[model samples]
Target: MATNYNDYFKKNNDNDNNSNNTGGGFTPPELPNFLNKPIVWIIAILIVLAIFAKPFVVINQGEVGILSTTGKFDPEPLNAGMHFYIPIFQKVYVVDTKIHIINYKRIAEAGSMNDTRGGIKLYPSINVLDSRGLPVTIELTFGYRLNPKTAAQTIATYGFNWEDKIINPLVRDVVRNIVGRFPAEDLPIKRNQIATLINSKMQEKLDKLQSNPVILESVQLRQIILPNKIKDQILSVQVAKQQAQRVQYEVLKAKQEAQKRAALAQGMAEAKKIQAQGTAQAITIQANAQAKANKLISESLTPKLLQLKQIEVQGKFNEALKVNKNAQIFLTPGGVVPNLWINAKDKQKASVSK
Candidate 1:
């Protein structure tokens, strides 16, 4: 039972050697005594970890890495991902390539470069003199981003404060130059033109700069603060224009109404004339038909037929005269027919006449 552990290991090693020699089995080489130490294994593991992990940086999205050796920046920028640098001899500077905004506003409460939200910087609204020497305030927002291709050169030339040197000054200068070209009263009216001019001028200047460090995304003109008297005058002009438009609309409406009434009256007069013409035409046609019928009757009459009609009328009158004794008859040139007749039935008058 208390057999020495060292003897057990030695015996096993001796058996392994014998098996390897006789049975032709392969044996592993023994490690050195120094290698058996736990500290040496731990040191090797740490060395491997340090090589892979230390003196490295992970560049996030929308960012580029600037590598500088001893104080000189590399021209080509490192893209987003892990980057390696030599210890103490090299360093990496992360420059943001994402779009950023600079808002020139009326208030100054919004902090400067320290603003953490989307790298937006705020400055006081630009105060400039108009062509008339009147004071004006200009409010606007500028959008831009560092050119990733020339990020290193941009940083080298302008440093980390590239926005101040490239963007801020350029924007202010362009705004002042463009705004000062016009009178204060015209600023609000020519806002769009002013914005276009400022954008083009700023972009032109930026492109002309060495290496073109910043890419101009947008330049928006938000507001133009004019003097109070100019504001009042503009307001008055707007009111006058509205009144003129209203008057023109009313005049047009009246003209339309008058035309409608005239049309209605003309339509009524035409209808009455057509109705009168139709009535006259109908009367004329009826009279012509009646006259034609009478002519036909007259043409169909003969002497014999007239005599027969006269005989029939005489017989009817004779019968009538027999019933009324006081009846009197008068004949015409055609004596077979009575032309006039009277019946007087007063008895006293009949006696007197008889």
Candidate 2:
């Protein structure tokens, strides 16, 4: 039975092999021909091409590219837009060419008398000799710009640490030199003049140092720390000056008001005088007119005119006596008979006599 089983297995295996030899057996699918090639070679070629094309870099507006070959800086700069470089041999660094602000605090701990020292550790406190040779601390800020043309040189000479070596030291030196010339009191009050001096000196020194890459825009005094004993004295002086100016202004205002009142009074007096004069002139004119009328009347009264007037008066009296029942006559000087009547009969007789 074992021999028969082995014979049967062998017969089946042979049959399977025979079928595979023919077209009756199944076969597995093959991979694409291109995938059969070495993938490392293709990857190496792509990397090489990418390295050669490494020069394609876009530089935006207001930016400059610093190119270096083998760690040596190129003299010429790469301007904005697309620029190309060798990948392995050359390097490009982008720098913003626009204005930038760097805020440096000169006094960090404010409002404390003990921490009055300026915040910056780069420079020692400025020593300005007063008349008494006292030390004063001054805080200030400076604005600067990086010159694009000299940026490469600055990096080469100062190794990109120019702010510490060139800028801060020069600023400290310039400030000290300028502040030393002025007294402690002048540092706080006359800061404008001090700033002007500092700016001028800083510009001169920077030009000398050939660090023209950094430009000083403006210098401003942030604070002045004085000894506690003298602070009140300085404040008092300033207050006195202000008070004096206020007093002067008040005096000037009062003087102007007094002058205005005096002028008004004078105007009123002048007007009243003119009115009184006019009244006096009018009275004199009226008196003269009255006197003239009296003179004319007296001049017209001659002796004959007087006699005619007397006769006229006597005739009027006689007529008046005729109308009255009682009347009388009185005799005066120069045969002048003034008529009077006692009764109607007497008045009729008197009229007949006239």
- Candidate RMSDs in order: 9.0, 10.8
Across residues 1-354, which tens digit of lDDT does each residue of candidate 1 receive? 655545665677798899877987767676576765667878999889778758899999999999999999999999989998986789999989999998888765666544546588777889999999999999999999999999999998988988988888888899999999998888888999999999999989999989989999999999888899889998999999999999999999999999999999999999999999999999999989998999998897888878888888777778878998777777778664434566676534422111
RMSD score of candidate 1 (Å): 9.0
TM-score of each: 0.76, 0.67
Question: How does model 2 fare in lDDT?
Answer: 0.70
* Global lDDT scores for all candidate models: 0.85, 0.70
lDDT of 2 by residue, 224-324 (tens): 67877678878999899999999999999999999999999999999999999999999999999989999999899788887887798788777877787
